[model samples]
Target chain A: MSQVPPEADLATQDLPSDERAMLERLRAGDAAAFEQLVRDHGGRMLSVTRRFLGSEEDAQDAVQEAFLSAFKALDRFEGQSRLGTWLHRIAVNAALMKLRTRKSRPAEHSGDELLPKFLDDGHQATPASEWRDGGLAALEKAETKELVRRSIDALPESYRIVLLLRDIEERDTDETAKLLGMTSNAVKTRLHRARQALRALLDPHLRGGL
Target chain B: MLSCRELVEFLMDYCDGELPPEQREYFEKHLACCPPCVAYMKTYQQAICLGKSACKDEEQKPPKMPEELVRAIMAARQAK
Candidate 1:
């Protein structure tokens, strides 16, 4: 989750000297500075987009667009936060814009099937089983990491985006709501449900039953 | 004691520490005796931790940036 604070302290004067110099160079239209910016941040930006957009091609396009957008807005950057932080927000928005424009992938899971079921008496239909402590550490393995990513990608678009914004990107509820054009309540509900569904999807693997 | 269904329903609030004191007390009272709900809460928390760690791993071992992407963005910036 993003440890970047919800409110970035916009005291440009407090920016580190190196970042300040980079901002100045960017604002001065130094070609090398712009290229350097891309080289420095592009990989991380692409990673952010790749999660939002599972397609490599789309992720590349979104990162490309994000860099261009950032370049165009260079004058507006107040140096309040680290340049990387600003770029992260821009990258996320670019990916979301791409998500809005594209058609949904075939065979996406609506995530409803994975949600926990309850009986008429307000009890779990199936009692929850405990996975051994530290069982989830399997996610560090290459195959398990892929499984985790695939599980996230399997979620429905709306819920997936909410999950990405809230959990992965660590955007606040109000900001995520604004970004998705939904109410905070809606974001919270979707985030909670998304977590539940994702938990169900990973249960077998976590339980070593996969 | 809160039923398992009600506990699950407000699970997010409880975990987030957003539930009011009374409701949270009831929620905990239920968890104190219900082994299943305790397991459910632990797994649910672990799921969130796994998701964040999985994504954060990308930063530790970032995917290779395609050279073409760098070229394209630079070209676009030059055009602008």
Candidate 2:
């Protein structure tokens, strides 16, 4: 006899009644339901697109594209994931597409500058200093928040995008890889390098803030 | 003992708790004798935490999605 994992069995069940009803309404071309869906998920979707696209015009365009893509693809939605999760993925893909189509500028290539330096013997060239006692609590200050935001923005585009997808969006390696059209190993390598660079960038301020 | 350079390379895996058991043991043993690596690891983790916190603030106060954008999206869909 085959033994189904409990979680897998749960996944195969229908989405909750309200969500199911909403899906049906959407399928039936209910305009109000569609409006509700956009209003409900639009803000987060916009935020995500803005981070990836940077330009206000591009972000708005990406959000519009994402919602439209989601609407057209409603019939393909499976019950395995929440509608919001599914929508989020579409939004990320929409942003990526916009990024692809954008006019190419010279690659910034700043990742090496921001990455930690090591001695020939494989030790950090610069010793790390202890940060101030506050840790994340210091983010309460708007100034500190802005500093962190700017540091992240300073990373090279490729590394920044990976950092945003992996660290900020909280996407898993496989999903991130699939979205970025990279291998899982490539995703991990980029993620690691991004973190190391970010750490180096933040060190001076975080350390002095103490 | 893992060299500080090797430890730096493994920082992500060690922090993610993805390091194999034997490797993790070696990583920690190095940390025990290495103040600089410990400090590096701490700040590395703090950088991630600060980033997530800062970004969460941005999401919590998302830039308002223009109403016109919504109308535009609906219009585009209808036109299609």
Candidate 3:
């Protein structure tokens, strides 16, 4: 048997009864239940969509589309998962669809430039410098956060999307793979390269922040 | 006996604790002597911290969900 990843437990951890009731109410066509669903889940859904689409208008539209789709398929909801998780999946799907339909997607390119370089003999060509004492400690500063956000936004779309799904969302590799329609190995590879690129982007600023 | 380049490849797995026992020992041994690698690892961890912190934006008042969005969703359901 394949050993389950620890994060798999997170998926099934909190199958709360309240979400079950919410799902029931939603399926029964209770307007209040519908309103509650929107009011309760809308903010987080918008946040998820925003990370993917990066535009307020696009994110709002994606969340609206997700809620509509979820409402239409209420009868198909099996009460097995929390209503929020199901809706979260729908929202991510909607966001990806929005991304797909955009008229001007960012052009594709290899991220090899951002990855570390090694000499033919396997030594680093240019060794990474140690950040000045506790230089990285300033990462939580609002200015640093803003820089981090921009660095992430600067990545190529495919790598950025995987990084957001896996790292920012803290999603399991399997869920990310399923959402992005790639093998788990592919997701891991993209995530690794994304992290490497992001580190390279942030290094100088973090060192300067020291 | 992992080279610096080889050890860099093991980083994600090393942080994930997915490396086998022998390989993990070798990775650590390499780390003990390599300041650059140790710094590389710290920055790597910092990268993950920054990435996860991006999600904290959701916990705040997150630019109010569009006022028309719920109404639109309700209308869509009614039409369906």
- Once superposed on the true structure, which residue ranges of model 2 sit more than 4 Å away at CA? A1-24
Docking class of 3: medium
Q: With candidate 1 superimposed using the best TM-score fit, by how many Å does residue B65's alpha carbon deviate from the native?
A: 1.2
Check candidate 3 and list the clashing pairs: none
Pairs in steric clash, model 2: A122-B5, A132-A210
Best by TM-score: 1
Winner on TM-score (2 vs 3) = 2
Residue range A71-136, candidate 2, lDDT tens digits: 877776766677877777778778888888888867677688877788998777888777886467
List the global CA lDDT of all models. 0.84, 0.83, 0.78
Q: Give, for candidate 3 chain A, the lowest lDDT window spanning 10 residues.
A: A1-10
On DockQ, the leading prediction is 1
- For residues B1-80, write the lDDT of model 2, one tens digit per residue: 68998998888998889999999999999999889899989988999999999988987776666799889988888998
In candidate 1, position B24 carries an lDDT of: 93
Report the candidate with higher TM-score, 1 versus 2. 1
Candidates 1 and 3 compared by lDDT, better number: 1
lDDT of 3 by residue, A67-159 (tens): 887777776666456676677778877888888787785565677898999999787888877665544467656777678878887887888
